[model samples]
Target: MIVEGKVVKLGDKIDTDVIIPAKHLKYTDPSYLAQHVLEPLDPEFHKKAAEGVIIVAGRLFGTGSSREQAAIALKAAGVKAIIAESFARIFFRNAINNGLPVLACREVTAYVHDGDEVAVDLRSGEVLVKNRGVSIKCGRLPELILNILLRGGLVEYLKSAVN
Candidate 1:
């Protein structure tokens, strides 16, 4: 999959609570949850995400609780993909399981900036900064993970296979 969108930059060690604060956990609706996503970090994150964006975050993105809601909120809010220096293991898997693509590029934070247009090629693991004319390499998505994302998450992928 190839995803292109404006960047939404965030710092390191952003935990699940910051992604979707605990106060909003009562809601199961993805759209409703999205409205409060990253509220602690940026009050206008929902507005920016609604316009479609690619989140570029520093090391250890998604470092806390393994709530699937974090990924759901982001995907529902129109985050095409996330490029981070590193990711917490559970969050990484949860992202893919929710049909949200995530990439890790150690050099990504050094080159990309907030609001810059970028294109991410999951198959090739290439991130192109459209405004800067720069390319960064990220870890490639394995075929299994790609399959899950292509079918719009694990449940859908399994349903299709069983059908």
Candidate 2:
């Protein structure tokens, strides 16, 4: 699978609370959660994210809280993928479970600037920063996880499997 989008750059240790504030946790609906997604970190994120953006962040992105809603909110808000130097374990799993592709590329954060176009190839684990003409290597997702994302998350993947 391949995903392409404009980049939304972020810094280190962006925790779950910053991804979706605790106060907004009352809403379970994906669209509702999306409205408040990253509101604390970037007030204009929702507007910019609505057009399908890819997040590029520094190390330990998604460092606090294990709430799956954080991933759901990002996906609903139109975040195509996230390329970070590193990720908190739970957040990485939650993101994949929700069909939000997250890649860890040690050098991606340095070359990716906000609004730059990026294309990620899941099969090859290559992240291309279009404007800069740069390509960074990332770990490829295992086939099972890739299939889950291709089906739009675990639930959808299971549904197809049962058929």
Instruction: Please tell me which predicted candidate would have the highest lDDT against the true structure.
Output: 1
16-119 in candidate 1: lDDT tens per residue?
Answer: 99999888887779989888888898878889899889999999999999788999999998999999999999999999999999998999999999989999
**Best TM-score among the predictions, by candidate number:** 1
After superposition, candidate 1 runs with Cα above 4 Å error: 161-163
lDDT against the true structure, per candidate, is 0.91, 0.90
Listed in order, each prediction's TM-score against the native is 0.95, 0.93
lDDT of 2 at 155: 82
* Model 2: residue 79 alpha-carbon error in angstroms: 0.8
lDDT of 2 by residue, 29-143 (tens): 9999998899887877888899999999999989899899999999999999999999999998889988899998888877788899999998889999899898888998888
